[model samples]
Target: MDVFHVTDKDGNKITNEKVIDYIQQSLGTNACLLPSLRRTVGVKAASKHTAIELTGTDRPGLLSEVFAVLTDLKCNVVGAEVWTHNMRVASVVYVTDDSTGAPVDNPERLSMIKVQLCNVLKGDNDKRVAKTVVSTGVTHTERRLHQMMFADRDYERVHNGLLESRDDKFRPLVTLQNCVEKGYSVINIKSKDRSKLLFDTVCTLTDMQYVVFHGTVDSDGPDAFQEYYIRHMDGCPVNSEAERQRIIHCLEAAIERRVSEGLRLELCSGDRTGFLSDVTRIFRENGLSVTRAEVSTRADKAVGVFYVTDAAGNPVHAKTIEAVRGEIGQTILQVKESYSKSPSEETGGRFSFGNILKSTSERFLYNLGLTKSLP
Candidate 1:
């Protein structure tokens, strides 16, 4: 017999007997022997803000318009994640009542919000219907984004021929084969690796009603290789060519959704209600379209990171960036290094623009009641 040891984060050994007992308690007496029948505990963090889920055709200035609508309705955005892929945009925004600093629970207000946001999402040329939903519950934002895009069928290649024009390096290579003896569909993926690449791929598979029985993920330098042996929920391997194609498409879409394209712009300024709206508007007016955005508020300061490109989904001209930066106050909005850098290389002192933007513009916004008073 070989010896095995288990330990907590602090490295103190957990006795083998205790580990077995814990496993038994977790599985219960009548638990099935198959790994697929096992249950894992999940702990959800409590949140005091209502979440708004939005999905629609993506366009320049769309996010700005969304934020402006929320600001007008007296909603304060505390956190948000925005992703745009293949002309489709999906986001989960967490917000609270500006006056109460609590979740927006009024049915009437929520109804009005839904109507207004739905209108914003449905532009003049959007043939597919846009959707907006408000819920007062804690959810994994990233996972929800994946589900939203999948349901919207963003994996379907756009008719504009943009997918065919992508650089070879950015495109992921995915192959699927059936293993006759094991009764499993084996998927192999090779792509440039970044943070959350595994989570994105695995999450897509799970949401597609597939079970991953075995897998291997290996990273060599910047590239990653993944292989998964999976079966459908009905215990079937991929049976048809169409199903196989869809699985490949979805996995490719999942990997591409989080790839931050274009230049990375980091903004640090005093938190205000209409701050994001104004900044995004500047980008839109300057012919820049945001591809991905992250918004967060820490105390009285607001920090935003945006990946942006030209409205045509190409690299922005240098002069355009300079002009936009000048208009938005060069100190408040600074261009960061490329998003492709590894986490270790990107680490440095943030907030180098000292004093956190206590300028006249901030005071003006505050005077107009756009600034929230933190308790």
Candidate 2:
């Protein structure tokens, strides 16, 4: 391996040890998590990178779900590792912004990201009896009551012939200690461990533009522990006690609401041309954003997993989910003998940066209040 040495004007040889220390001190904070160590949301304590870890009970469809959340949050996955041992799953991922490809730095934004992830984990909790009552075709009022309980974690339903649910013994927690003299912020996170929890937290931080330098993570059943040494974009440790408190508060609240709402829709239809386009049209017309999607075909059947939210980026309300499903059922039935070809469809063959820009621009416009009813 070749080594590059730092030099002064006189070309004095600088000890490599001093340079390595500066690199660790000045480079972004940790991005990966080690068991029994700290916890965090996103990567390197630097501006454009971060290191992170997530651990939870392992299950089928876990990896895909994590990516789905990342796609929904608009975080770009640059590198990742997925491993499962015994009944637990651990993932280490490096993420960046979808648009700017930079670290996420805004606090309010990062909090929301972690919260969404926690909700995903909530959906995976074995003790939760409701388990998305809205998806089970229950009464509107009943669903409402149950969802509230989920969000508040105050109600429990019976499983089997006995009451099998219990309150969360471990409340969610997130903390960051500024180690500026050492040049990093130590971030710790404790929440319900679930699949993709790591990605969601890390992606959130990436969106906020913070970086991770060093991190460690471990899980015991449903509770997860993580630690991260981080830095801000300007390479400074968090200096305010108020700021630290705010960080803790936001993560606590975010974890509470993570899976208390939102709908995960699965659709299976007879395959035909242009089906995806029609589905997306339904999403746009109904003010839905397809946060994540997986589509596949087996024999004559087409199956898809859709992680969705309203245009405002909150979970799709119960009323809206119902209405959208009804519309989707009708649209799939109206599938054409062949896919409806469009201008872009015909132009397919290679990736186009222009098309990417156009799509992003459309979302930006919509976020600024675009409407189908608009002229």
Candidate 3:
């Protein structure tokens, strides 16, 4: 059992280190967890191109080709994991130094790196790879929320100094408050449209099910388009033992803490790893039982909106919920949230960039018939 700590893009600690081999194995490749460690290293931590771990479907001479490219980029190869699953080869390589002190956050640079890596690993083909970039901004007040809601993407770029900026007009129509209350967002990207390049990339990476809201192209200069991306359901299932453990720990703790007070928990998160098991354990530990519940995943995010009761259905106290929120976020929510929103309906349609990448990898394998052997 390997323990790992999860962090945000800006090097903020999100979850404590815990044994998560089950989660890594659930990823269909133990190497899938490599990026988690790299991310924690902090992008701002300056280093020459250092060795990095790489893992994915393997092709002929894929390793050699990738190494060749790494050599050209002056990156070091420190570690690797290569295996074949469902007729695809997956490899993990640890490279040092990302040329620009760290992997450049510039959109074009990131895209170029992805393309270069993919070309070497996958060759010249329309293999779909989605990349999501999420930058967290702390808003201790509601006024800040309003600003984020209304801020244009270009304004965001200018503020953030993004060289390859997205359209200024594009904005998430629904606010976080709206998402929680509505159980869905009104904005989203259309996977079928070619014009919504960035939005489509985000949707694919995040595994969002978006209904095309609107689109337009300018007769002169750059085109203008806006579409909202909404998450309908978490595309993958909690088939991994690791996710199951975390879920169980969180739910059980929540239930146990609540039962001591003679109440139930009203869960409003999506499907997750050990949700039911954890909830049940907590109830059992505290001499309680869940009367009725509803839990599930929405678009790669975990949620469990359950009206917990005693053996007989009864309302849980508000205090019980308040008591358990911290624990829930600390454990089960780590994989679900992953720099995105908390693993609750309160923060939906928002997620970390790495989660989006993981989703894209899963989608790619599933679409290509590689994950069929997972179950």
Candidate 4:
């Protein structure tokens, strides 16, 4: 792997220095090659919108209220990612001016936005302080969510006098073992396979100031297994039992934050101001609480995917779902899947979203890559 050889695009070795010299001469003299090039293969362009970070106690209708406040402030939400875990919610929302489509940079307006959002986050009975901040820096959305939740200490278990229990199968198996000979702490995780599973655990370790020297990941059907050899930044392995447990809990929280824990709902409709606010209001009215949400706009259409359960985090009844569908228009908002813990409470069948939206225009389907446009 350390061997070096100069080759053309076709993989043919270039043995002639004259050819290299000619190529260099053809280019300008200002062009110079560095000894090594840092890789940035998957970096995305900077967003032209303002990013707001929010974390607080989770509750029904909280997201709706937040969106309503943003709409009232004339801030248009272009995108957002929301996650809820252990009765704590954290979200990163990207917004722009409704008219200019530019980041809302006015200091006064931003302060008002923060104040209103902070009020909504700090509901009447929240014991922990809610937080709201406007961020000007660029950060990976998902990674930032992990950092925020970690800082908010979402890993701590909450006992709010409710019979809340996570299913054994859904709980991630996290164990830490120290390798004395190798001078590394090994972390092994076994959990159900899903998108970003590795990313969540690695981000947690990285944020905790651990360096992963080596790692291996394997998945079999729905289950995934990961092992990482890591050490502290100070070149030490996990030094104490408390630290080991802390790492384990943090990793579990990271993985669980993104878990969609309820019935999946997909909303496709024409973009409009307060669209999310109205829809989430309907959900709240129907006694549903959003566990996870991904909102985006493409062209003139708004696309949102939400996972929601009963306000108390129990499976929603079939009648409640029917009532919501009837009120929200079944065609515009469809149930894509169900993740209810109780099979008897499941109301929707597993079907492809494209099949459900067959009546939509071909252009819309083409834009979503659900169909190919004919020449």
The candidate that wins on TM-score is 1
Query: Candidate 2: deviation at residue 59, Å?
Result: 32
lDDT per model vs. reference: 0.73, 0.46, 0.31, 0.72
Best by lDDT: 1
Query: Each candidate's TM vs. the true structure?
Result: 0.78, 0.32, 0.23, 0.77
Model 3, 374: alpha-carbon shift in Å? Answer: 32
Q: Which stretches of candidate 2 lie over 4 Å from their true place?
A: 1-172, 179-183, 206-209, 233-235, 241-263, 273-302, 307-375
Residue ranges of candidate 3 with Cα displaced over 4 Å: 1-56, 98-112, 124-375
lDDT tens string, model 4, 52-108?
A: 778888899999898989999998888788888888888878788898988788888
Against the true structure, candidate 4 reaches a TM-score of 0.77
Per-residue lDDT over 210-236 for candidate 1, one digit per residue giving the tens place of the 0 to 100 score: 998766565555677777779999998
Note the residue pairs that clash in candidate 4.
Answer: none
What value does the lDDT take at residue 169 in candidate 1? 73
Instruction: Report clash pairs, candidate 1.
Output: none
Cα lDDT, model 4, residue 371: 35
lDDT of 4: 0.72
